[model samples]
Target: MKALVTVMPKAGVLDPQGKAIGHALSSLGFAGVADVRAGKVIELELAETDPAKAKAAAEEMARKLLANTVIESFRVEVV
Candidate 1:
């Protein structure tokens, strides 16, 4: 099974990196770019073939090690 984990900052959190990117885009003449937030994506290949089990394990991994529950949120997709 293949698992895709996307980790992103929670709403209302300050993202200095994102802000810097937004500023750079504006300087490059990009218009209407109101905001930008940086996030991470992780792709994992698992030995398990069952979709339900793979998703559950991925969620556990996200909660335990891949993401900070307080400041980050993660979504798991199985393929």
Candidate 2:
């Protein structure tokens, strides 16, 4: 099975990296672009064959180690 985990900053969190990217984009003439939020995706290979089990495992990993629950949220997908 394969699992994909996406981690992103929650709404209302200060995202300096995202801000910098937005600024850079505007400087590069990409105008009217706003509210750019940055995030990451992680792919994992697992032995579990069931999609439900794989997803559950990935979600647990996100809650325990992949994301900071106070500032970020994560989504898990199994394939």
- The estimated TM-scores of all candidates read 0.95, 0.95
lDDT per residue (tens digit) for residues 1-79 in model 2: 9999999999999999999999999989998896799989999999999899889999999999999999999999887
Per-residue lDDT of 2 in model 2: 94
Scanning candidate 1 in windows of ten residues, the lowest lDDT window is: 8-17
Question: How would you encode candidate 1's per-residue C-alpha lDDT over 16-64 as one tens digit per residue?
Answer: 8899999999999999998999989899899999999999999999999
Q: Candidate 1: lDDT over CA atoms?
A: 0.94
Q: Which candidate number maximizes lDDT?
A: 1
Report lDDT (CA) for all predictions: 0.94, 0.93
Tell me the lDDT of model 2 at 39.
Answer: 88
